[model samples]
Target: MAKYIDLQTFTDARGNLTVVEKILPFDIKRVFYIYGVDETERGHHRHKKTVQAAIALNGSCRIMNHAGEGLPLEEFTLDKPSKCLIIDPEDFHWMDNFTKDCILMVFASEYYDKDDYIFEPYKQI
Candidate 1:
C-alpha cells in the first residue's frame, strides 16, 4: 500500500536536517524538484519501474494518487518538510492545489526514461 513517511530530522542550534538513505529501499539516482508550476494538474501518469519519495520542502500541495484495479484513489496534503509520500511504480499520481511558494523535491530510484512512463490506460510507456 502507498503511504506517507515521517523522515528522521535532526535539529540543533544551527538548523535542521532531513536525511534519506539507500536503506529505505531503492538507491538514489535522479533528483528533481518543481516550483512555480503553472499547470493545475502537473502529472497524470505513473512510472513503470521507478519509485519515488516526494517532499514538500516549502509551502504545501495536494497530491492525488491511484493504485488502479478498482482501488480507491488516495489524496495527500503534503505540508511538512520532514514528511514524504512514497510512490510505488504502478501508482498513477497528479499534483494540484499548490501554494504560490510551494517547492516539491522528489527523489527517484532511476533516471528519467520516456519508455518508463505509463500515462494512462494502464499501458506501458
Candidate 2:
C-alpha cells in the first residue's frame, strides 16, 4: 500500500527547512525529479523490487495508486515539501494534476533497471 509521511520541518526567522532522515523504509540508491510537465499524466507502472519516496519540493501534484487486484484505488496530494509519499513495489501508480511550478523528487531503493519495471496499471475492482 502507498502511505503518506510527514517530514520534520524547522521554522525560524530565515525560513523553513525540511529534512528527510531516518524516515524512508529503504536506503535511497537513486534520485530523480520531474518537472515541466504538460497536460499528460506521468507514471502508469509498478516496480518489481524498487521502493520510492516522492516529495513535492516546489509546488504540488496528485498521485493515484492501486495496490493490486480487488483493492480500492488511493489518491494523494503532494502539496508540501514536508509531505512524503511512500510507493511500494506492488502499488501501481500514476501522477497527474501538477501545478506549473511543481518539482517532484523521488528517492528510489534501487538504481535504474529497465527489467525491473512492469508497465501495467492495476485493474480497478
Candidate 3:
C-alpha cells in the first residue's frame, strides 16, 4: 500500500530545513529526480522489489496509484518538501499535473534494474 509520510522540518530565523533520515522503512540505495516534464504523464509501472519514497523538492504534482488485491485507486498530491509518499512494491503509480518548477526526488530501496520493473498498469476492478 502507498501512504503519506510527514518529514521532520525545523523552522528557525534563517529558514526551514527538512530531513529524510530514519523515517524510511528501507535504506535508500538509489536516488533520482524528475523535472522539466511536459504535458504527458510519467511512471506507468511498478517494481517487483523496489520501494520508493517521493518528495516534491520544488513545486507540486499529482500521483495516481492503484495497489493490487481489489484495492481502490488512490490519489495523492505532493506539494510540499516535507511531505513524502512511500510507494510499495505492489503499487502501480503514475505522476501528472506537474507545476512548472516541480522537482520530484525519489529514493529507492534498490539500484536500477530493468528486469525488476513490471510495465503493466492494473485494470480497474
lDDT of 3 by residue, 1-125 (tens): 99999999999999999999999999999999999998999998999999999999999999999998577999999999999999999899999999999999999999999999998878877
lDDT of 1 by residue, 3-120 (tens): 8988889999999998875435678899999999764888888888999889999999998888877777889999989988998998899999899899999989999999999888
Candidate 2 clashing pairs, residues 3+ apart or interchain:
none
**Candidate 2 Cα outliers beyond 4 Å, as residue runs:** none
**Order by TM-score, highest first:** 2, 3, 1
Q: What TM-score goes with each of the models?
A: 0.90, 0.98, 0.98
The list of candidate 3 runs beyond 4 A from truth reads: none
Candidate 1 — which pairs collide? Answer: none
Output the worst ten-in-a-row residue range by lDDT, candidate 2: 116-125
Quick one: how many clashes does candidate 2 have?
0
Ranking by lDDT: 2, 3, 1
lDDT of 2 by residue, 1-125 (tens): 99999999999999999999998999999999999999889999999999999999999999999999999999999999999999999999999999999999999999999999999777899
The TM-score measured for candidate 3 stands at 0.98
